[model samples]
Target: MLEDLKARNPHIAIYPVSDARFSKYGKVLDGFDFNQCLDIMQTRPIPEEGNCYVASDAELMGTDVAGELSRRFYAGMPVQIGYCNGNSSKLNALEYHKGSEVDVAVTDLVLLLSDIRNISHNELSSESVEAFFLPANTACELYATTLHFAPCKTSSDGYKSIIVLPAGTNAGLDSIPAPKCEEDYLLWMQNKWLIAHAESIPASKGAFVGITGDNIEINY
Candidate 1:
C-alpha cells in the first residue's frame, strides 16, 4: 500500500521530521508531554471522510498543554488549542495564519505544505506543494510563512493531531470585509487566509477559491 501511494504521487517527496530540510522551516518541539493533548482527542469522535477541524474548542483550550503552548510559543499571548482528526487523502487547500502554529500528531499522519512565497495573484499552484511524514507523539512548530491545512492519514485507519495557534485563529468573522485587494479575498476566517482547490469543500462553500491544478490526494 505504501509503495502504491508513492508510485501514484511521484511528484511528492515524503520526508521524516528529522531531515534537515524540515528544520529549514520548523523544528521538533522538545520537553512537552504531548499525550495530555492527545488524550483530549479520544473524548470525541473523528469524522469518517475528509477531516474534522475545530479552531478553538473550550475543552482543548483548558488543558495545561494549552498554557505551555501559549507561554513557550506566543511569548504569553493567548493561544487557542484545537484538533483536526480523521481520514483525509487530499491536499484540498492550504491556509496560513499571521502567527506560528504547533501541531502534535496524536497518530501518525502526513502534512502537505508549500512555501508562502509560491502564493501569487491570490492563487497557489498545486505543483509546488510537498509532503512530510510525522510520527505519533511528536510535535513541530510551523512558521508563520508555511502554508498548510489538515493532516492526511498515513494508512487506512485515519489520524489525530492537536493544533495550537494564536487565539481566534480560524474563528468565524462577524462580517466579511469588502476586499481592498487580491489578498483580502483570501481572508476566509479570522486570522486565516486560505487558497482552496476548486474541488475542495471550502471552494464549494464559496471560499475565495484560488488554487489551480489537481487537488493532490495520497493513495494510502
Candidate 2:
C-alpha cells in the first residue's frame, strides 16, 4: 500500500500551491469557494509523523532507485526536489532566527552549508516531527516546531537554503515567539490539516524521491 504512492519520474513537477480561497496564515475562509487543487500530487508521509524533532542543518530527503529509504525507517525526512521557483513576495520571506525553542517545520527549499549548523531540532524519537521552510540565498531559519506558515513554492531550479521544524502538539503557537509570516501569508494556507499529515501525495503525479540510506552522499 505504501509503494503505490509513487509515480513515474517524467510526470513529476513540484507545483506551487496557489490556494486562492484559504488565508495565507492558515485560516479557513468560512463560506469561501474552496476546492483542493488536485492533479499535482498527493503528499503522503511514508513513515509519516505529525510531531518530530528537527536537528540543525537538516536537508530535504530524496530517494535511490532501489527505494529503500521510503521503505525503511529513514524515509520520513524532508524531500528536496529543487529550489522554490518565482522567489520573491512578502509571503516568500519566511524568517528564521538563530536559536528558538519549538517544533515542526516544512521546507520550501533545501538548506545550504551556512544555515545548516546554525539551526537545530529537538531530536525527538517517535515524537511529532516538525514541519518547516528555509529560503534560498538568505541567512535565516524558521523556529523549530514553530508553525509560522508555509506552502512555499519551489523554483524550477530549486532553492539553495530553506528550513522547517518537526510537528508538535502546540496549539496554534500563540505562546511561543513564533516566526513572523509575510504580510499575505493566509493565501497559501490552503491545506493546513493535510500539510500536517506525514504521508500526503503531492496532488498530481511525479517521481517519489525518498531517503535511501544513512549516507547523505548523492551517488546519483
Candidate 3:
C-alpha cells in the first residue's frame, strides 16, 4: 500500500509512520487495544464534500479502552476522544495544541507535518512540510510542537481517524483576548493555535494567514 501511494503521488515524498523521519514529530504507539473504538468509528459517516470534525464524541469515549487511554496514554490527564472523517487532499492549514495529540488511523491516509520551530515570526513556509503515511489501524502520538492538520485521503473512500487530545482543545472560545505576541494571532480556539494558507477556509474565516507558498495537493 505504501509503495502504491508513493507511485501515485510521485511529486511528494511520503514516509511511513515507522520511519526515523517521523520520530522528531511523533512516534508510532504500541500496546493499546483500539479495536472497540475503531469499530465504532467505522460506522460514522464521512462528509460528502469536506471534513467532519467532532472535538468530542460520547460514543467513542464510552469505549472501555477510553479509561485505559486516560490512565496510560495520557497519564491521567483529562482527554477527549473524537474523530475526523473527510475527503481532504490538500495542505490547507496547520494547527498545534498545548499538549500532544494521539491519532488512530481507521483507514490509510497521509499527513502533512512540520515542526513549530520552523515558524519564523508566526509564519511557516509550505516548503517546510513533509508528508507521512499512516496505514490502516495504526496509532501514533504527535508532540505538542508538531504542526499538523486534517489527514489527506489516499483513496476515493476518503479518510477516517480517531483524534485524541486534551479536553477542550478545539472547543470554541467565548471571547477573543488581546494579542500579546504574534503567536496570539494564530489562536483560533481553546488550546488550538492555527496557521492557515491564504486559500483555506480558515483563512476566509479570519485565521492568521501564516502558510506561504503552494497549497500542496496529493495527487493520489
Candidate 4:
C-alpha cells in the first residue's frame, strides 16, 4: 500500500507512520490498548461526502483507556475523545492546537503533515508538506507544533480515526477576539489555529488564507 501511494503521488514524499521521518512531528504511541476505542469508532458514521469531525463524544470517553490516556499520555490534563470520519483526499487546510493530539486509526489512512516552524509571515507552502500512512488500529501522537488536518482516505471506502485532545480544543469560540499578533489571525476555533488553502471550504468560510501553492489531492 505504501509503495502504491508513493507511485501514485510521485510529487511528494510518503512514509509509514513508523518511519524515523515521523519522529520530528510526533511519536508512535504505545502502552495503551485502543481496542475498545477502535470498537466504538467502528460504529461512527462517515459522511456521504467530505468529512465529519466530532470534538467530543461521551461514549468514546467512557472507554477504560480514556482514564489511562488522561493519567498517562496527558499527565492528568482533562481531555476529550472524538473521531474524524470521512472520504476526504485533499490538503484543504492545516491546523495546530496548543497541545498534543492522539490519533488511533480505525482504518488505514494517510495524513498530510507539515511543521509549524516552516511558516513565514503567516504563510506556508504546500511544497513543505509530507504524507504519512497510518495502518488500521495504529495509534500515534502529534505534537503541538505539528501542523495537521483531517486524514485523507487511502481507499474508496473512506477512513475513520479516533482523535484525543485537550478539552475544548476545536469547539467554536463564543466570540471572536481582535488579533493581537499576526498568528492570531489564524485562530479559527478555541485552541485551534489554522491556515487554509485558497480553494478550501475553510477559506470560503473566512479562515486565514495562508497555504501557498497547489491544494494537494492524493490520487487513490
Residues 1-220 of candidate 3: C-alpha lDDT, one tens digit per residue:
7899888887789999989999999999897889999999878999999999999899988988788889988899888999999999999999999899999999999999999999999889999999999999999999999999999999998999999998889999998799999888899999999999999999999999989999989867
Which regions in candidate 3 have their CA more than 4 angstroms from the true location?
none
lDDT string, candidate 2, 157-185, tens digits: 22222222232221142332233542222
lDDT of 2: 0.22
Candidate 3's displacement at residue 18, Å, is 0.8
Please write out the lDDT profile of model 1 over residues 154-183, one tens digit for every residue: 788898898888888888899889999988
* TM-score, model 3 to reference: 0.98
Q: How far in Å is the alpha carbon of 206 misplaced in model 2? A: 21
Query: TM per model?
Result: 0.92, 0.19, 0.98, 0.98
Model 4 accuracy (lDDT, Cα): 0.93
TM-score of 1: 0.92
Per-residue lDDT over 80-108 for candidate 4, one digit per residue giving the tens place of the 0 to 100 score: 99999999999999999999999988988
Error of 2 at 214 (Å): 34
Candidate lDDT (C-alpha), each: 0.84, 0.22, 0.93, 0.93
Runs of candidate 2 exceeding 4 Å displacement: 1-135, 148-151, 162-220
